[model samples]
Target: MSASTPFVKMNGAGNDFVVVNALERAFTPDAGQVRALADRQTGEGFDQLIAIEPSTTADAFMRVWNADGGAVETCGNALRCVGWMLLQASGSDKVVIDTLGGPTTARRAGPDRITVDMGPPRLDWREIPLAEEMDTRGIELQVGPIDAPVIYTPGAVSMGNPHVVFFTDRLDDAFVTGSGSLIEHHPLFPEGVNVGFAHVLAPDRIRLRVWERGAGLTKACGTGACAALVAASRRGLTGRRAVMVVDGGELDIDWDEASGHVFMTGPVEVERTGTLSL
Candidate 1:
């Protein structure tokens, strides 16, 4: 292992990341290494660690690791940051990024802004892969009590990753963390799930908070935002397009009616460049 490696710290809508160009350095971090780097107090803290690798089918391959050192499928925010980096390097307007989920296209929308075609939402219960068959529009999961649950009938969707969204009028921290943590490990989700607490302000706007499966609560979750919108639309709570207001910032999410593809547009910020002692 190398003593040190260069890294680029970036964020998209406040979902921060530590990006290592494996295409340049050829580095892979094991679970322990990833956990070390995820330490906020002692190491370079980030919601996720992105390794940029070579891909034959796409412009590049993105490997994602959550703060808990779990290797996940896709990360929408990281894709935007990586897309911006690749676009700046190649000076191209569009780029295709391959992930564990599948291939996605990203295009330059404006200064520091990128729009990613995040493919279509997986609607089937088998796709979301719950423990058993059920309706994804509103699952049977509930919090609090069976007769009078605090939150019930959450919608499920897989945006490259598993998520269950609970629509409510309250957006308090306690409800989000408490209920979210409980649902993330629910037996229904065999692979675990990201839990989203969505408060719909209008047909086109929602305030959301997410408890990421492997990363706990984060400031922003790009895929979570997409999942929330899709879930809301399926439940007829909102239309296909909305502005998702997260703790870190806002994301514009549009589920295309023609293509059935979800497009997420957000801003990416280069926080800093540094070296990590591994």
Candidate 2:
């Protein structure tokens, strides 16, 4: 390691991550390097890594990496971290940042909390890119004992990523941890998927826990919230507007009945700032 890398550690609804700035120098960290950085004990520790680089669009170009060193198109929490950085950088309340998935706009709502418009949701089976095409809405997927009797149908939605949400009778704490990974990498999801176990508590509220693709388990996933709301709505379990409770915290989710798109509103919290040594 030549020098310690300056970085920001943040989390949105408990999806912890480290944001790295690549503008000054490049480390070209491999999977092992990324793992070291994401180590909960020894490394900087995070679920994912966000590298900010010089960009032709907006203020910067952001690259996303799972703790496993795989690339992902979008990350909602990192967007707010970027927004936080942008607010400090440009002295503005809002910023437009481009992602490989698409462009994202975020606004500083409170001290360190931010609200991000995660763009529109993609609901096509082809978009979710399931191995087989079927109705993404209220589709059948099986894993463990849940089967059709337990989870029945789930809504498949993509926010530049794939998600499968089970609107069950209750938020099974055990299943969320035990069965989540089984569903996330199911053969049905060719590119793999983020798995959510959701239980509708009321007309506009639900509880959730997620298993994220490539990153294994995390505190929360913003795109997972959007997908859960959409899935619940399709199953007639909840209204278009709902609040999803995640391990990290809470996220307000709304699926526009008219537009067929889902919107997720949440907060991003910057825990600390530090420099990574290689």
Candidate 3:
């Protein structure tokens, strides 16, 4: 690692992260190394690790890794975090971030508020990396008790990241705790899964909680908000655009009709910055 390279610590809602750039600096963070660094007990840990690199097509490339050190695609919060950092560093308000899944656009809506064009949601089974082919609209998934199910027929959507959504009568921990574990480890999802339990309110608002794949239950998840909107829209549960209230904060989401893309708007907070040595 370089002696004088700068890094940033940022968060979207409450999903905190530690971000560094490989393009501007020089550091290929190994999974073991990343895991070690993000371990709160051992180092300056965080929920996720965001690495920014140079992109041939877009303004930059973004690589996302869970606290467990597994690299994944599309982080709504991380994208906004990157956008905020880019704007602060480059004085530009618009950015395109290329990831392992695809490229996404982030535009600053206002000071501390950023909006991300998260591309389209994939409903197909293969796109979600399900182990077997199944209907994406409503899959025959059940958990908890057989007769009295905790979750049934979850609506699946991929916001670059995999999310399995369960629409509930209300938002509570009972449902989130019972069903989240089963579906996340279900035979179908090869890459594991992020689980969301949503309760619709007035068709224009939703109450949501997320069990992130590797990060466990976080206060909020940006991709989870995007996935919930996609799932609700497909199930005829809500309109294309609505506000989601998570345990940490709120996010505004819109599923575009023409382009079939999902957009998430929220705030990114920078807490502090520091460094650690292995």
Candidate 4:
């Protein structure tokens, strides 16, 4: 932390972040510092902390830290929020962001709306990097009574990060929190996983809740929504496109069959902007 460093508080739907531009300044926050900032009761709490650094390959490089002080590979909502901000500042219709996941492109759609090209979904068992090879469409896992499982046969996908989606008739609260927590740290997922509970409302609409890997439950999870659409499509539960309704807001997801890429469109808002003392 600098004596005084600038930051912007922004949110995509309800997932909030504190973004810092570290292009010209050194702003690497350790675990403790990140934890302090994310403590909702004591500090400027946020779901994640983002650092924007100069990039040689793309418009900028994004570094992210989860609320629990752990770093993550990608965050779709953060990308969209930052992408829109950068696009507005540069007057560019498109911006490329380089992340640990890969280089992703963001395009202007409408007023305060951005569409992110999240690339293709990684469906291979090895790509999800499970402890061992297994069918990703429906991994061999179960919850509840062995005789009659409450949640079983979840689909796994990686949208730059790991996720496991359980398509149920309803978004059961207990299931989302209990089963989600247990499966998030399950040994099968060596890298851990975001747990998603989705209920199909129609062929093109679905309601979803996510227990994020390092952040626990959040208002929304862009990557989780993308993963849900892919997982649903894989299981033949839904078409390639759908609207994912989360707690905060709605997101449009399209899994293009032609290019095999997933595109997510949503709105972003700047909550506040100020300087913080590190």
Name the regions of candidate 2 deviating beyond 4 angstroms: 145-149, 169-174, 256-261
Maximum-lDDT candidate: 1
TM-score for each of the candidates: 0.98, 0.90, 0.94, 0.98
lDDT of each: 0.94, 0.79, 0.84, 0.92
lDDT of 4: 0.92
Candidate 3, 253: how far from true, in Å?
0.1
Q: lDDT score, residue 158, model 3?
A: 87
lDDT of 1 at 11: 96
Q: Over the stretch 197-267, how does candidate 3's per-residue lDDT look in tens digits?
A: 98898688999999888777777899899999889988899999999998878999999999988889999
- Per-residue alpha-carbon lDDT of candidate 4 for residues 1-278, written as tens digits (9 for 90 to 100): 56888999999989999999998997988899889889999879999999998999999999999998999999999999989988988998999999998989999989989999999999999998799889999999888899999988889999999999988875667667887889989999999999999999888999999999888889999999999999998878899999999999999999998999999999899999988777
Candidate order by lDDT, decreasing, is: 1, 4, 3, 2
Clash number for each model: 0, 1, 1, 0
Model 3 residue 136 lDDT score: 80
Give the per-residue lDDT of model 2 (tens digit) for 1-278.
Answer: 45677888888878988887786776467788898888889988888899887767767777888988788888876777777787788897777888888887777777767777776788888998888878988677765476345565677888878888876655556766666777777788888888878878898998887778888768888888877887788778888899888888898877766765565677777789998887
Candidates by TM-score, descending order: 1, 4, 3, 2
Candidate 3: regions farther than 4 A off: 2-6, 169-175
Better of 1 and 4 by TM-score: 1
User: Which residue pairs in candidate 1 collide?
Assistant: none
**Which of 1 and 3 is ahead in lDDT?**
1
